[model samples]
Target: MTDDTNCIEVVTLTPLAQRFSYRCRTPLPEPGCRVHVPFGRGERIAIVTGSSPCPEGVQIKDVRTVLDQQPLLPKALQALLEFGSNYYHYPLGGAWATALPARLCQGEPLPTPKPELWKLRSDATLPQSGWGLRQSELLQRLRRGNLRMTELGSGDRQRIRQFLAAGWIEAARESPRLHETPLTLRPEQQQAVAAIRAACGFQPFLLDGVTSSGKTEVYLQSMEPLLLAGKQVLLLVPEIALIGQTYERCVQRFGATAVAVYHSGQGDAERLRVWERARSGSLSILLGTRSALFVPLARPGLLIVDEEHDPSYKQQSGWLYSARDLGLRRAQLEELPIVLASATPALESLYNRQCGRYADLRLRERASAQNIPQIEILPLRKKRLLGGLDPSLLSACAETLASGQQALFFLNRRGYAPALLCHDCGHVPHCRRCSAPLTWHRRQARLRCHHCGWEAPVPQRCPSCGGDGMNGIGMGTEGLEQFLQERFPNIPILRVDRDEVHTPRQLAERLQAIRSTRPAILLGTQMLSKGHHFPDVTLVGIVDVDQGLYSADFRAGERLAQTVIQVAGRSGRGDAPGRVLLQSHLPEHPLLLALQSGDYGTAAAQLLRERQQAGLPPLRALALLQAEAQRVEPVYAFLHAAQEYFQGSLDCSGPVPALLERRAGFHRAYLWLESTSRPLLQQVLGASMPQIPSLPGARRVRWSLDVDPQNF
Candidate 1:
């Protein structure tokens, strides 16, 4: 083999579904390191995957500079990425791009952690006569004890660097200091923690705990041993909003230096720093959202997915992968333990427990001496609501506030109203780019489409009929907040939602404000529902329970139940008695009646039975081959042509319009594939997927395949 034609395999940050071959000189960079390579008359950064022998008579481009001296990702993390790519049927390059931080993908220099402390080397003897006075003094201080580099003068720091090069001094590793003691665990919590701590390898446990049942405490205690033994822990939450409070709690238990938080909301440099520290085994614990699942853990000991059932754990776009499922695979690969903690576990998780794949650890009672919240349904049989609140619910909130406790109103809509209705013409203004109606944002005086992000000014008159009567049709958190403020003018009404709180600092401040204002009214979309602890929030009012009563998706019931239970969980967490009033038009609905029992297990079991009977997920394997384009015909034409390649004993439905047929100026459609056996489905997909892009209609539309998809 010619030395100049040595073949190397690389993957670039592109949507292409395969790796490329490049020829470079000998001594190539190891797999997982970033490399600059020539492509299409330009240079692009790529990741070195492996090497293969050059094909005879086949010309290839040369590799440019190697970005890192060593592999950026650890071996185990690389494996996880590869496994996720294959399982999700996404492109390998795209998978790598998603796994790595944006700066790394752009060929930015790998972050090098600066040492904080310095000490004298073991064998170094003081140069009594040859060294300068400042150097001698610095060495004397170092000999006494490790000194922080930050605490030294500039002259001393420069001298210390010289001593480091001369092998007279070395970097010192500081141990993490414990700032707080562990809280006393309940009996069930102790059992759960013991089970987790005693596990040897490759164990998956479902920490099924109710609201305020101390699941976090169990996680803390379970992680203590591993952290003390010099092992790292990974904790995944479902929301960016939750990271601030969770990080604070972890910092209180473990010192601030020992804990770090990563999410998309942070700056690129900050994320890269945390990634490097975790890869170097210096960070003791990492808490983050879904994207942090790919972060490299040098000493992987335990992985915990808080609120594992959350749909936020599933990536809805780009790479369709579930962090919860991938975390399980990661733990199995690293031979460690993983805990999936949730009050309302997903049906799939419960099924896995039933199938003996995961150990079930349950916490049935509240950790606090407070009683469980009383749940009731308020029937809305043509009852007029004051800005979407049932009178009974309003009275309950008033009573709770009268008792010196807080009340929360849960509304999953953010704007002032769901739509701008032309009352005179009986016509509602819809988004021109999508099939959905534009939401009315009264505060901003704009009509916004939540689906396509299309916005327009509120019409002074009906555009279609030239009518003057245009009004908001339905209630949202913003409108509800306004009405509540008018009703309880003296009381504080805080709105917690995406528009109100944008950063971790803002969220922290808002939460602190909530804590300070007792007997306050909190209202927001689902942003306030996940894992927020308000000890004084004794009442939770689910503003519109009927919104989710009917849906086209099969998992709608499960999602609805989970949302109700999760929102209801936010109340009655303190010493005072708690209550939840789910205002519904259909109070007699089977799902609502089932939820009235306050037993998610029972509701989940019923939903599972329905799913099994309907041949849906947890009992069947499913994937969606979706296509979208500017025109409707191209989407259908592409999907129809793509459907002909499938060879399987499986059900292939669609070439049908999506639930939202139009979104963001694209006409969307999909092909649904389902099978009884997962391996057989994979086999069919593996054979057919390669031929999809080559079809004649493929170029007219953008298409992707989503395995185990959560969204319709």
Candidate 2:
């Protein structure tokens, strides 16, 4: 017990930015190790962030017990977390705490990785000749050698369990068996891979390729050399649904032990295994969504963000950090090459490319030289819509179906309808907990608020008019599927959305069904738009294109353009040339025109120039000071004081209400801050962190500072 290691600074996985001091006895736990320490009334297993000698006049409690034998977070990961904490203006404790699995924080011992091997046990009796073929086959498979658990399916599991129960088998763990799938790359893909390999350090490359341009192939090809070196690669996608195909592909190419998945969808034990694998450098690739960026790697070689522009990459709640942005910084810190591949790049990334911050690698030609989808703009002026589908677009879908080809109807909204309207009084149903209308889910027979997730049973009569003439006003994907079913009667229509597919297996089954069914009509929301290749689909019909044209948010047009191109890109991947029919009320809309001509680059360029002239992002930096309360006045008062706190230091916009002003029973408002310089804006926010929470009405509301806000 050295006097020099007498006290320690602890950081809990909580919102408090303040670090706590605790006395330590004997050998102190190193930084990044976990310790169970007394918090307010109970105990919390906190991370040891720093340590020093005991203060002269302080009385502090000692750390109860060390929870880890070695450091939980690597040095590089700790440094990256520090940078993220300062940059996002978030509490390091919260980010650091959330980085560990929930079980680890709950004082549960870290779970050990289970050996995936099973074999026949010694001294076990052999089955007699009366064994069934299924039992015989299982025994024969294990007789040859111990089989990896990943090599068997769910049905095979029962057989293996029966064998184990009969004292015929035992489990074992060993080094991960290595395997590699051979592949031939196209000329352009080869060049992209070579360029990435030749990079010196901290080089950012934008794989600005079109959808179905073999970007994944290029990513995999580039990783081949690094995987052979036993170095780890970080692959980030936008959503959990997208992880299935990518994970399967990675595991198939490099064996099951070589790949580990990190995402919120997995259970605690599963996530812990991946965390252990990542930290131990046993994983060749750590694949996941936004939160996986915090996972420490033993030997990181490359970072790849597929669909970098997708808004899902931005964390919305506690830490409003961008995985793509952090990946760039992480690569710089680690001196590794990174790739940001997207069909429609974000305006910020594009601006970075324009400024030469990122090398623009454009793979113009599709791998197989498949023809680009032909786009047609169908005007909806004076034309009646049946479930939001234009007559011309409907006819095109029917023709494609008759020709034994698939048809995809891309509509970004779910549920049966947007609102339940009363014919008598022109009244609409609204949510009590939110300042928004409740969408009608026909299957559930309920009105659901998309903003706050509050649900209500469908009323037999309109509340306002006390009339039974309640009608659904706007059609959604659910209603579209129902309508298409009635129209076709003979063909199958499958709807894909958050409501339909809640699991990876469900989504995989839906996709597999779509592949097997020809002349089928597929209806869905944005879930079907990103990173999906349906080669059999020869036609695409986009409904409700006007919804994004009049959005209050500035980035709506940019997002719409990206989605339009991505949805259109889903077609024409097969041998036959495909076409996309877009139904729009404003036929001449610039974004529509860009999509009609199949050129998103022009739209992105124009949007960037518009942002520059308007003193918005990519030109002038911005941060949002958001506060919400159960009562409205406290929110406005707190924001007004915050605006005053930054009066001359930075320019402040209104203590205005949010787009959806009141959500989940909280009245929200924000003060918009802008600056020509990024550093100055960040400095202003950092300076105000202490004062904003101490404002007169601060304790009455929930508040946060969103740096580089993606939403309005």
Candidate 3:
């Protein structure tokens, strides 16, 4: 280390690359200090990771100015970030942008918390007369003990207002106490908790409990020992919607001040505050989505990933990192124990368990002793359907509603209609730039492409033949909503889909309304499925299950099985028994039969055998290099050159048309790269990516490499 002043030169953190570098400036603070620097004619905020001698004879820019008076990120988080950048093949600076909150990245100052308190006056005493019934109850409770300011109810507020005006009660300064009572756990839950508590140090435990088997209770119990040891805990959920529910439960055990939420939904200021709180050791528990894995804890001891198999845990955009994978890695690095809680574990996780990479802990029986929902298959080929609902499903919904219970209709598609067909000429409206049909959006009076987000007016005549006789074809969530509205004119019907509910607040409000009013029917897409608990939902109808079974993607069957199970799990959560009616053209399909019998183990075994024989994921590592250009030949030429570059180490296939070959005026083509070992594939990609980008026709097209792609 040099002198404090001349020790560091210019320190800069670039958002474009997420790299932290230092140049000789006058004198600078220590590494980890935040500074402002001149970057491309604009000043941006950056952190100093280190100070080193400027490279001789190389042009160097001096540090502009220092931003934070103190260091923002500690050494541990810096190491983790460096690991993530190299592992994900993403820019270091870009990873930091993802790790830090938006406000901090934009150079906002940290906030000072304004703490408030409530106290009873010295002369305050139990009311002897002239108190309203509600006020009297509140006064009696307060007489028994001291009450915090924020904890006062409306009745207490009214009485307090009177007392304050009369100078009979006074407010005092005290620390905030925002704690609630924990729920009573069942015996099985207690046993699961005890077993998890007995484990120590860097252990991997899988909590394979049935839906509502009190898996969360096991998590809470396992977390207690870690927290008691003064260690921080990180809880990862699949979506932001889950954060609220899980956060509430955590607050009930550990006070509100101990837990903080991190997600994209929060405003910049709130996110920055939470970030500071987590970093400063003001918060002990952190709950969030996949990105939460990057949170910098003061002392991380335990990492819990709830619903470990959910695909949402794997971020498809940007860095393309899997949160579940990172959780395991982070736990190992920190020498901490991790709990992966899931009803149906992913194949990769199951493989890990089989290979002794993780310890298995099964909560085989339901904690509450509730029976699983009855699953009935309705063969669509033999039954006449009305607006996607079969007679049996409709009858079930009617019976459920009549008994004062709720019903849910699951249709994965969301637009009003899937396609518009011309009756006169047998023509269909297709997206002008993509090889796919344009969906009709009745509310918007336009045909929209879900993939490229292209929209156009609903033409009165077919473009091919100028025919006026056209009709909307196939059922979607919107169409189903219309059908249910007309059929049940007197009952309230709530449609929960991407189009209807766009925000977490909207989804929460709709769910709350459904819970309060148990007689309504919920008609929507798979958005209504996954993780929501509706105790009064006695009936669930799967509108069309055949689409998943016939999709070109190899993982379609697995996805369909997971989705069917998740949707069925939503029913019969309470004491009232529930039923599920699945409508499919292939009712006798092996996957469907396995699902109906509640035999996920058998289904997974069969799928694993098939995957092994076919050389799919978990057996081989795969990557996809996609290229798109205005003309199709350019993509082919680029791919051909790429194929020539990787001569022997890797297997190259497919310069074929992508699933949707044309999109937004571009023709797309993909080349598949596969290897039995991950290291070999990484090496091939590392060597070939730079060369492929500079090939002929490369300048005229856009390309990206997707490692472990979920969709083709």
Candidate 4:
């Protein structure tokens, strides 16, 4: 037998499942350590997953170098990575690469910040002249005493910078104490907080509260104990915009140093800093988007997912992991409590509560005893449209403005027009690469494809028939914004959408602007629907609600109902009663009727029953095996092989075209794997995935397996 030192071999994790062993000149490193090792003739950053004795007379190469002084991933995270790899049937190394930030995977150095607190100079005094009304009031407050330089707003910053440049003000550095007073929670919020705190280990609590019901206050209160005990809290918001909003609240309650924000929109260095802080126990609270679920907390105490039912929680690509689901899993694994707060929870989550998997905590009454929004469904099937706004909606907007309240016009689509059609030829402009129509962006003078992001200058004449006249086929936010601007020229109109609010900073700025101006009209897509507090908005206009009534996707109706209720709920948040006008072709639809009546519970129950009868999710688990190839045959052929490989363990269906079959030059197809039992589906996938790589044209195709898929 060889000596123990001589037996040392470097086993590197490859994109493939099998770990290849190499000779180690130095001692074998621990698992999770990044090593520079020879792969063929070149070197690669290979993570050491294991080490084993080589076979007799088998030649091996030595590791070139160790990339890190310590293991980048901890043991628990390593296990989670392994679980993701096996469950998704993806390459182990590829899965690990996906779990880490791109900067870390690329071996970038972490950032070092020399934080210096800035204080108002002794010579500095508040400006007494040449200021806007708002700026003048703010300066008057500052005249009482010197404040932190960082505490000023953009407007204040500009004024201060001007003052400093003119020698009217000065700057100084001093250590500043971070402090904030806790806001008082209403009785219902207090009760909700009490119930959440009472729940001990591995409990799932659903905090059912309307907008401005003080859910955030309750969350903060429940988190205080965890923070005091030196434990970390994971706070997940639906979108990056919400991340900033939630982070601001956390900062208000727990100071800026105590909270770190994480999301894709942040710089790599910022993400790395936050990651390190969370892992090192410097950050007690992490406010982030969906990916924050993977952040390594030194001592995790609580997991909170605000707006738990938001579709943004479901990742559309890569591993397709649902952050909401992963949050609950992490809580269970760590034996910690988790809270899912939502005004309208997804039917699946509601079912979990019904089945006793989650403790239901209800905040039935609004914090300030504000009444629910009064909803009115305007039947437009037999009515003539005036710029997609009915008389009732127009009159309501006029009335709302007359009463000195804000009005919101919610249109889900975002372009100038959804499609451009030739009136004579009955033909519409379409994207060459994607199986979708090109939308008209009149402001940009372009035809854009939303799906594949392809764009081109809009042609003045129709390409199909060389006709000079072409008409926009459908209305979008741009059209609504223009129409509203024309109709209510005297009223200030703010349009919020992906196009208008391109960044988190922009979204925050616009939100701040809207809050400051209470009598403005807000028009946009789903961005105005959820997680925002608009106390002054007393009117909501849903431009169209018929899109989901006949949608092909099974969950469309449910999502539509949730979105409508959420948008409408934004109204009537203050003292005066509010009103919502829903324009729909199918005014008598059951879902619309339920939503108009503010009966989400009844709607959710009905949806759950339908889902159960149809063998949908929550009753039956699903895994989607999707394949894409340049040629359609390869996709179908591979899916058929996978279907055969699964055999009897799981029910297989579809070698059918995906929702959008041809996208960005690839033909896509999917195979649905269904099983009442997760273990059975897991077993089937475990057996079948091994045979996929050897299938014909496998190298030319890309594929992914989505377990418990939220969308198809």
The models' CA-based lDDT, in order, is 0.87, 0.86, 0.76, 0.79
Q: Give the least accurate 10-residue stretch of model 4, judged by summed lDDT.
A: 169-178
Tell me the deviation in Å of residue 711 in model 1. Answer: 1.2
How many clashes does each candidate structure show, in the order listed? 0, 0, 9, 0
How far in Å is the alpha carbon of 147 misplaced in model 4? 18
C-alpha positional error of residue 547 in candidate 4 after TM-score superposition, expressed in Å: 1.5
Error of 1 at 523 (Å): 0.4
Please report how far candidate 2 places residue 495 from its true position, in Å: 0.5
Ranked by TM-score, the better of candidates 1 and 2 is 1
lDDT of 4 by residue, 1-712 (tens): 3333533333344456667676666766777777777787676666777767766666766677766666677776777767767876767777666666777766565444332223345665645567788656555655565556567778877776665676654443231133576677778788878887787889899998866677888898888877877788999999887776677788787777678888899887778888877776667888888888888888888899999998888878766768798778778777889999998999889988999988888877776566776579999987888898898889889989988899999999989999999987988988888888999999999999998899999988888899977989889999888988899889889889999999988999999988888578998888889888888999999988787888767788789879988998888888888788999888889888877776577788888888899998878888888899888888988888878776577888887788888898788988888999978878878887777788766776898788877775
Q: lDDT: which is higher, 2 or 4?
A: 2
Better candidate by lDDT, 3 or 4:
4
| Residues 306-339, model 1: lDDT tens digits | 9999999999989999999999999988898999
Q: What value does the lDDT take at residue 627 in candidate 4?
A: 96
* Deviation from native of the Cα of residue 90 in model 2, angstroms: 1.3
Query: Who wins the lDDT comparison?
Result: 1
lDDT of 3 by residue, 1-712 (tens): 2223343533234424435344545556666566777677877777676666655555556676676766666666667766776666666666676777777777777666432234456666645688788866766665666566577767667677776777665654332232544456766677767766776778888777767677876787677767756678899989887776787778887777667898888888778777776675666789988878877787777889998988888776666667888788778777778899887778777777878888887866655446777579998886668876788788888898899899999999989999899999989888878889999999889899988888899998888899898888998888888889888887899899888999999988987888799699988776777767778888889888897887878888788877888888778888887788999889889888888855466677777787889998877888887899989888898888777767587988878788788988899998888999999898777766657657776777777777877766
Per-residue lDDT of model 2, residues 1-712, tens digit only: 4354578888887878888889887577888888889888998878888886766666678788888877888777788888889998899988886677877777787667565679888788895778997788888898898898888989888888888888888876443333665567778888899999888778999999987888988888788878877778999999998998888778777777778889998998788888887876657789999889888888889999999999998889987888999989889888999999999999999999999999979877776557667579889899888767788888888899999999999989888999999999999989998898999999999999999899999999989879999989888888888899899999998889988998988999998898899989988989999898788888988887798998989899898999999999988888878899888889998778767767778889888888988888978898898999999998988888888878999989989899999899999888998999999988877777877768888898899889888987
